[model samples]
Target: MANPADGTVCNGKLHNHQKQSNGSQSGNHKRNGIIRETQQNGKPYFYNKPFVESFEKVPMYLAIFTNLSYGIGTLFGYLRDFLRKHGIEKCNMAVERKEQNDFVPLYQDFENFYTRNIYMRIRDSWNRPICSVPGPTFDVMERVSDDYNWTFKFTGRIIQDVINVGSYNYLGFAEKSDESLTTVRNVLMKYGAGVCSSRQEMGHIDKHEELENLVAQFLGVEAAMVFGMGFATNSMNIPALVGKGCLILSDELNHASIVLGARLSKATIRTFKHNNMKNLEKLLREAVIYGQPRSRRAWKKILILVEGIFSMEGSIVRLPEIIALKKKYKAYLYMDEAHSIGSLGPRGQGVVDYFGLDPCDVDVLMGTFTKSFGAAGGYIAGRKDLVDYLRVHSYGAVYATSMSAPIAEQIIRSMKCLMGLDGTTNGMQRVRQLAQNTRYFRSRLNEMGFIIYGNQDSPVVPLLLCLPSKVAAFARILLKRKIGVVVVGFPATPLVAARARFCMSSSHTREMLDTVLKEVDEIGNNLSVKYSRHKKSACPELLDETSFELED
Candidate 1:
């Protein structure tokens, strides 16, 4: 049988070459165990008998036909390129002569051609306005403030000095402390900057080990392993723990890194509704039914993944309920406390600590030093065996270069300062101030008719604008007023859920909050957008109520 589409033999091994009318064989010939053909110049050509025999003996004739098709394709490609070059040159000359004031005719012709071809259609798919409007340009950020009031330089524009309401420095550690800088400088002098190698290849420094130990102790875990960066820690750790026959039950709103890690592991991943324990239970039951059973090697393990605090939504995970469900299913649990650590709990020990839950019960606790510690890198705290296993086997930790010595040292100092004797007192004070600021900002924003999301205690507050274009416009208005805030739209969140995300900080003063709320109120009124409040509170309130005082 032959394929009519490309002159390929479909069922048989031999290719049929039609004899020419000149009493000579034309095109390529195949007969018995030999291939003979006439060249374009009319010369006769012969192919090896063994080669012909082997080629003819192939079970699928489609391969030979494919090669013929490829040759024809190449010829067409060349002709197309040649024609395009000539056509484009001619078009350019014609347009230059006829269209000094307008390119309407040229544009119409392009549109016609673009719609007619599948490849062209796909190539121009991104040309449409998917988003509402363009975001604030660098040209708009021209102002630089000497005073530490909330102001960001956009473009070359000098906007007014607005209060800073959109920074993630929860404890105000970035501005108030020279401790991290001092530690980094000292470590750099002692260790000479970067370690310049992966952990497995002499990248391990004393400070790195010390910091890991400090993190483990702070989190109340048995052991800990550090990574060069936070993203790598989350992305690499998830894949290292689950693979093949294993099933991963992830929260739908888990960080992108966790999603990528689960994807790379090639595990059976089922996403429960965001923060919905019932959905999780349903998925777990289904997983048990479909998962591998019997032999230890064949039996699959179930891993539950969640974030301590969602970065975008500013919601806290219901750890107690989740733990109960995990225990019932005999599943492992992994928590990314990236945003929670140094921002939650009685002493800023994070969500697990806030609930007074036993650290041993939690299978894995991971956190980053970028936010609260005002440093870089990430760490995973777990049982000794797990940490040891990952240290040797984790792809990202093993292959990627380790954190620089100065960075590691700075993190160590920051951790020690955070967990020291006065740490509890200082941390509590910062948490209180942050809570006060958050409450004040939220209360004022709500009164002014602005919609807010996430837990009330959370520093992250999102002002919903709904339209992607409005989100960008709102950000520009805030920028013009000399306020720095981030506008999150499409891909980061759903198109319809576009918003302006504000990260409140303890470093912010009462006056700053007042000023920011005023601006927000004015903007909302001008835009005629109705605002609402959606606040959720966390449990196990701290006992030290008079630990700190808020600065005016």
Candidate 2:
């Protein structure tokens, strides 16, 4: 046996012989031997024949390779962690898989949620645009407050002034009326400003009862009930009056509060086209079919709801047509005179008075005192029995705190003023002045090429802008010129019908109107707005129009 210099053994039988490098020596090394061989390159190399054959069985080499693999994997994992910490590795494959698994049912849930949100979609679908004017908050405030000669102050420069048509004091009763101020003072002194409890509890005050009576008397109804607020009154009263198993035939353009109230009632609700008597009649007929009389007890009552005046387009509801439909369908009529009372009719008694329709013809008459009375509260007047029923049963009136004593007193005072002994004095004078102002403003805006909507007699003069961006711009420019007007869009009105709603107040002077008109014309010209006259005819010739004919 020949041994290598490293002293390794060789297997002769399984090995093959190889030549040595010592000067042509005829020596043979075993094939499976550990030997040193000199190659042609003059390098001596060592090879282990048996060991190479069994390399897979070597534990030491396997361990070394396993360690190297693990080290590389650990380094990669650290790098991944670093990237994740810095938000560089955005997509988490594992998380994505988990999310997909979780989202399948969630997606279905979302679909169901959207289906249930139909009313929300309907309410929001009418969002429209205005103008594209822009400016800083401070700049807008300075312009509007100064131009309108209004005394305005912000609690801090950081807060912006709340600008909306609803925010303006329409009758000048908010800040200008001494009587109103005194009433509030007396109420605060006596009742401490707030009721501090719901009406059913300790909030029912004598002032509330008095105001309810006054409202009922004004509307020529037997009795009335008051609520905490206008919206609450609508939302709570409508549903409380007619809930489950009842049907509600509502105008398409009715206020959101009415819609919400009907929905909350869980009643079958059918919406007719805006002021379309035919559609209302069709719906009423269909309701009869759905609620056919299996028995006398099985038949359900129907309620037809309409606004006295549509707020968005400033259109007055055709009360006569609606009343006729109600009579035909044998349905109860509920009129929300929120925007009409104190702004329409002979003594501002609203739609019924405007049409000279008997109060008995209508089932329920609801109104708010925020606008003309310069106070905050709402009431529903109707048959004494119905009013009493609502007072005891309507959740809005029963649970909510009654109207403040001061507000009630103020409203009563205002109502008394409106119904002066001479009929053409006091609040009547204010009404006339306001109506004349509205007419003058509408005519001037029409002459200057603005598309004005609503009845000429309406206090609400909406200048159509057609785009939300344009409406915003018109508002910004007006504010820049010191005019505090409202730009209404989206959800309030359809997106395609966005407008700059100018609510003319009795407090606004002729000089103020002229200045506003001139500024509006200048702005319209600069913006290339095509000013056009409103093509709609005024109300049909009633006895009231005889004044103009007689003068002619």
Candidate 3:
């Protein structure tokens, strides 16, 4: 995928993004020296080991490696170049100053500093919004019209469509359509588009209630409440549900919204290692025993928040294990299904259905409609009472604009189609095919000597490219080759593991994927980003590359 519409912007959003030692105060053994080599699971992972790791106080680690074949002076030069290039050192300096309150004087010429030394010298590679719709293949603009100009790059031509390996249109329902499109149209005819009021006031429509019912039914929940924006559905709702006396057990890789929501709740937030259930259990046990530091009393409530799928890592949640832990701890579970709903399981009811787990085992089930539903907004599904409480208490209901009736209708119709009430198995078939696409693409990519991430069931697949330049080069090369893929680096993922993320869709044909795979294989070798560092894997032998589908 070239771009993710629902890109979570969550590489350790509220939590610290750096990878630190598991414990505190290991002590500064050395500084301004050659970085000690690092190993992952006993083998060297070829990552940029830190030149100097700040020990004891600040807990900072700077990994700047440039050609170990060269000397220490070469290392320093690369460090300086990197600092200036990413504005990372500048950011750290600002933070250090901010900690001292009046340390940053009013006389600081911020604009002048950025223009003269920072912004002007930096690359303008990010935040380039596409004017065209993000579809399976869509037109991308080249420049602002001066007589007449619209250029699309790919296939060595101008103003032509490019095959998208970007965009999180998981089920290929992003475009405006037959039944779902008609539903939206009919809704527009009746509601005349925008409601133009808060959901608390006159904005609430019959379709809103109807849509909520469909979502609840689809996910096998008692009830569901929806908000106009997907991000707010969790961020705004978390505060209302969990408060100061509560504790939030969050996954380290949770989305920015989850992090923000935890902050808003004013709860004591403790993060567990991503998908590490043992670490989660340890944290829960500790929190349960110790409670808040000052009070030494038990927490008023405890909320275990996790995502159904980790977007950046391209990994699915260990829902069954997490559920067991939550039950043992007697804590409420909040599952953010933003990337998983309508893209998992036999019937696409999400992780719960995929694992055949009890739906009610989860206290709060959250998801965004943007990915799989091909609609806007988000839903929080749980018990009827929790939803009823949120209607009056949730700030989103009182302040935010209601989701347009048309949007709600579209979601309703889409859900009906998925549930097979639309007199067709089109949606179900799409789900199965999308899974096949994911397994086939991942299996083939892995076989081609590209180290891939995420569970086999997920559509989000990321290929690791160690350096930032390689990440940029990969996006550029793939675009020139007529395939679009989303590149993630530095703050979005960890500093080292920069990768190109390819999101699979049911609309992506076997031929299209084969073309993409071939182009990517060529580019990976040309850019020298393929599995040079990959240790011998026992898994690659398991993948059958002759066919496009995984063995049963």
Candidate 4:
């Protein structure tokens, strides 16, 4: 791996990347990266496309036939629906067989154990890929009740419509048919589909420039750089910013992408309790005193990583105190605003705006448009020098395709609407309605004896269903009642903290909220998951998980 901060690969090669002085940043720079290129061709590959490279040798006609056959097989996938609605499908978990005597029986038979005990019971509900647009309401293949089991019963249906509290489409923009989406349509006519190449490879478009400007303006930053995918925006950019000599102090509950990015950067990483300022301050003090973990040498840089809004917990970042600590400890702040941008704050700029904090207070500001903007990408906005540096050195910029022209337009138009600059208050209205919706939902759930996690203002409201089996039961029962709820157990969250999270939308009506609350209350009561006066847990769920969190 290369140390990007100093512009040199492991072999002492002088890469094209060069650092620019803040006062003299008009300089241009070139970016370069390499990937394992030659792809093995099977039947020369089942599909011989002009774009993808294959390494296997086979005739063209055979490849074409293979492609057609694969399509045919995929076309008949609906046939599986015929049998699955009746009997339980055996799961194919990733684990080795217990063939050899020396092979660890537990490890080798893990797949079989999971399939029999866990997956076979809940696999049907876990990964139900949707065919229709996701929104406040969407269509899903409804399972038919064929027989009764210990946990639940199978139904007599194949598909049905359900209310969606599962998606992150906070403003309903993805499913909107409003005048704002018309801007996306107009741009599509002019720009075709994709930009066809990475922005570094000459695919940068004018709309990309406008989108960056709007984002910078919205977030009160000096400049902004956009990328094609939201997840990669953080995963790739972190490596470009920090390297081995640096230290990263991360939130214990930060996103998986941030975790992967820190590991890739090879930085000495220390974790703080989630949103716990005291724990963070403690870690920061240690980093400043002892420096790198094993080396015990002076640190080159220290970056504090956190999310604007934690997705699973639905909690807001303590920005004010965190900002104070960052300055006190002389650490750079990296805030991933994926959940907060276009969702929180009166103006919808994100957590910084929500807290009325200075954008310059944080070092590297990150966010995604896929949430409230109803678009497809993310951006890193900060000082002009930081933006410029990332443009030439970030791996995503070096290899990933530029964000689509029309999708950029969608973001631009959405930002303009939020700012009330497009001759409409629709943007502000969406922001206001979402705020109202999230509050109302939380209050109702609280009133109904439900144990919910997250701050009062967050659109992501999670109901703590303590038992893993209750996660499956909550989701299964809710879906049968024509409500779509998102649930996650064990690996995603701690085993005891499994939850069914409800994501509120600006598009949800008062009636929709009422319907969800009523149904949720009844189901929670029936399942004995409700927290009544006589039935409170010995270990209260109100005890913030941060208190007992094990730092990494």
Candidate 5:
């Protein structure tokens, strides 16, 4: 793969480039600067190869209805925009300031249009303020829009005992419980609320080191580094690992943090279909054979990026295959175990543990403490050299404020509980409980003939609702039933793939789950959302696009 070119630089080293052929230069040759090139596995324009759907089982009727909904919405939106521009109607949202009219407009017209014409109608379904801790159940502060969601006023009312399937409480550490609060309280008294400085400065404390060491031990890595922010952990450290001439092969459905990190690195990025091993292998093979674009110089590095458990689709990464591919192609691997850690595997060590794979096989192990750990901040763990390098080079380590002492203590305490080092099996019990909840919930949803996405064992469950209107209705109906849910549509997922995502937690009892199931069954019947009779496979070949259900 690192075949040297004739007089070209690859990986900061000079190599000899291939000699130009004596044949007359064609237009393509002149533009590409290659002479008499031969194809190894067909032409080098591998991306031009036919796009294959990873999961093509979306019912034909659902697809048609979804498109029709968007089509009608867009047409109305345009008509409204034209009328507003012609002074026939007033645009109540995102009014450009009189003074700022001279300057560039704050928002583009399209964004303002989407906000005003589309999102505002369903705005109440999202970002609902909660008054209680986001545990098994929470209190949602009720509000009503005065002018079609353009403005809102609190109703001076709270929806009590709303079952929470929205927050990522995972192992239920986020709940204010007695298990870790005492330790957190002690640390807060000892170190105060804020570190107030970066780790490179005066923010480094005994707790930080203690946490890092504990994290290293937990992940079975040589060392570990902690960051104050979860998103920054990916955005900042990725650039530190690869840049410029390096290549990033990312999953198309990767989280925004990974996307931002890849873009910031300035690496040549190419996405493979989500969880499609065949597509990924094709890209890797083509990349190895063709090397860099046009110049054909070897890439400085090739990094395959994936998530342990995709938050949106709720699918677990094919860790073993990905690791094998990385090894076969001599590429590096980076895994973000944000949702997987403390929620999966026999030991809750994450996807690595889930698949019974070696942790050392992954070059960069990244994760957040926010999800399962019920604490703030993130971490990167691997070899001691990698952690040492990040200590000096990572922007998060150098610039961002250090993690608060109490947060570190919380992670350390929770991690100890998880590892049974706290002299109890409470942590393991939580893991087992979470797994059981996941299986039971997913099986019930499937049995109810609801089209769901993700692995059966994953705690993050997404129930598909094809239309935007359905997304709004689903959340609203659930709220009325005293259950808080998170519904996503449009930009967050495919327009046809709007969904309500439920996060299962150990704190949730069997009664709570049964209540959710009963409510969902009634809602499904009312909204006609249970439109599938069979569970479709995620594999491309087994997909049955024509299969659909009609309500009796």
Candidate 6:
């Protein structure tokens, strides 16, 4: 296979490029007679162009068996519920609140039923606790359950050196020993663990100002503000930006935090198909021309919400198209780069940089430090006026405590490293290595005929397991073999699209990936999850046919 670090396929040629220069601005550039330039960025950078591909068709036997498993489970679940209601059987989980009988139950009936029946059986596959830093390998605290995942007790067994493909430690910064940690330790000693008050009160420390400045410079924005919590960064600031009269055109599969924020804003919300630019443009046109419901009045403003890399499906957003649509419709754009920043782009600057699009084009650039930086907190970077307005109006800034000192230091250090401000090429090397690792691993999985989802460049790889039972089995079996993975089913995704998501990190070496491939190949063979009927694995070269481009 062609070296992934040599860049992706563009116009049927391998497009390798150089590192970004500090003094560079968005413009056109050419190298090796290839028009390696974007309309926004003059500097040459690798661009992973988006492509359209469908999920592998489920095999007939697998589909039947999967449906049968759920069918039998549901039948028994209802039967057991009936027996318990009739007092013929006891429900150990039932709460006996005699005095509260007149009060309404807090849980929804269907949700409660699903949790007790379907979810409980497969719960062990998720939320597995680890004792060490979430690097390529970590120590998971072993546990035992007496009631089939309803309750658990520690087994006092530590599974050491388990390969972790579950975490969002993309750049491998989530490690115990690193220069970032040194900076964090120094800050902790100087400033203590946290600021006890809100930024509006006494919580605004020098670290906050420094971090915000660094963040603005890093993101190429006029200004930026930090929040103590990642979720709150979206859930709080979005409301402050738009309110009741405004409209939010959101991606259907947006993160829960975005959904919560939109709901809290009390804005008129509409969803379009995931990454469908045509649908997005249609919505934008409708919002602009048709106006608000009932009153038929023009809405105050419209905000299009999307993510850099979708967390579950492993899809990268169609950014250039979205930007074009945003400009065409005159609507504001809010991009959540929770999973993208520090993991993408030649410079690790997220999707905007990946596409060589001007950061200013995105009305709001929001991201968290948790994933790539291996730190806590989030930030919103944009025009000075917008950030200034948010500082006073956003609940996270006015009411919530400022980012912790050590966390701010961690972000500062990592951001510097990613931007090559640390006077070392280590950051760029990590970026290239991560790209290489992601492509190589993805190619191998495709070769194994294990159906995978999302863009080929995305670090998040979701291998289709198809059945909830298979999801559980895949995770449990992997864990037993000293590999840590995360599986999702039901509420997190469509019930039928059950999958095990493997997050790639720069920390993962080729040997580690090969080990995972060998074990997964064996397990897949056993579970019959290799449903792809494609002939590409045998041919090998077809895997590199995915697209990459620079929009002029």
The numbered model that scores best in TM-score is 6
For residues 133-232, write the lDDT of model 2, one tens digit per residue.
Answer: 1111112222113212212333333213323232324454545445446756777788776777877788887877777767776776677887768998
**Candidate 1 Cα errors over 4 Å, as ranges:** 1-162, 176-180, 292-299, 421-424, 533-552
> Against the hidden true structure, what lDDT does model 2 obtain?
0.61
Each candidate structure's TM-score, on Cα atoms with residue i matched to residue i, is 0.68, 0.68, 0.77, 0.75, 0.86, 0.90
What is every candidate's alpha-carbon RMSD to the true fold?
26.5, 38.8, 13.7, 18.2, 13.2, 5.6
Ranking by lDDT, best first?
6, 5, 4, 3, 1, 2
- Once model 5 is optimally superposed onto the true structure by TM-score, how far is the C-alpha of residue 216 displaced, in angstroms? 0.5
In lDDT terms, which candidate is top? Answer: 6
132-233 per-residue lDDT for model 5 (tens digits): 888899999999987888788999999999999999999999878665599899889989999999999999999999999889888877899999999999
Compare candidates 1 and 5 on TM-score and give the better one: 5
Give each model's whole-structure lDDT: 0.63, 0.61, 0.71, 0.71, 0.81, 0.81
Candidate 1 matches the true fold with a TM-score of 0.68
lDDT of 3: 0.71
**Candidate 5 to native Cα RMSD, angstroms:** 13.2
Which 10-residue window of candidate 5 scores lowest in summed lDDT?
Answer: 6-15
Which whole-number lDDT from 0 to 100 does residue 398 have in model 1?
A: 86
Model 1: per-residue Cα lDDT at residue 118: 22
Worst 10 residues of 3 by lDDT: 50-59
Q: Higher lDDT: candidate 1 or 5?
A: 5
* TM-score-better candidate, 3 vs 5: 5
Candidate 3 — number of clashing residue pairs?
6
